[model samples]
Target: MQIQGLHHAQITIPKGREQEGRQFYCELLGLEEMEKPEALKGRGGFWLHAGNLQVHVGTEDGDARSATKAHLAYEVTGLEAWKETLRAQGLVPEESVPVPGMERFEFRDPFGNRVELLEVTEDPSL
Candidate 1:
């Protein structure tokens, strides 16, 4: 068997700072917060759902450092709209990454997690 697609992307947040997550992921990013399972209810953090894609923010030791090398990439339809939303929240896209066949940019979450928004265009050879 082979893997079909990515299930979720787990990001880290400082302990007891889940409300920040709600503000950023839910309020700003427009992701819906889902209830944690019964078994995992005691654990810290929250779950966000964008359609079928999931983003899990878990609590961790407080650190000044932010995620640099690792990041999550999301496929989006309204790229310009998303950028405007990010700017409206004062979380402007850091820099637009140049990919030959794609339009994309990177932005940091409130907790300092890097997320890439991508828009793929049709291939010439159809």
Candidate 2:
């Protein structure tokens, strides 16, 4: 059997802190906000569209903690420009090791969630 692409990614935020999640994911990250289904609206969360990926934030039952094991990565066209944009928003972008064949950088979301910005090389074999 073959699996298709990702349908959505879910991140858990502390209960009653949906607003904080919104500020970081939406306001800081510049992800376009999308409305969630009516049935899931009462669940306390927000949906965002990141390119072809859908990011969903759900409220966790307890305290919020950093997601150190997993992270979401985005491929951008202009790496330097995007890095500057993030810096202007008061977010620091850290230089990351060259992925075997990709140029990438890493940064943390307002909630300390790790994210990577990669620029695909013309020749991926590089």
Which whole-number lDDT from 0 to 100 does residue 22 have in model 2? 81
Model 2 error, position 98 (Å): 1.0
Best by TM-score: 1
State the TM-score for model 2.
0.80
Model 2 lDDT, residue 104, Cα: 89
Clashes of 1: 0
- Over the stretch 21-49, how does candidate 1's per-residue lDDT look in tens digits? 89888887678999889898678999989
lDDT of 2 by residue, 1-126 (tens): 888989999877767888888887778667989999999999898899999999888776743446474778988788889899899988889998767667889887766667888988768654
Kindly report which residue stretches of model 2 are placed more than 4 angstroms away from their true locations once superposed.
61-64
Q: Where is model 2 poorest over a 10-residue stretch in terms of lDDT? A: 60-69
Off by over 4 Å in 1: 64-67, 123-125
Q: Could you give the C-alpha RMSD of every candidate to the true structure, in order shown?
A: 2.3, 2.4
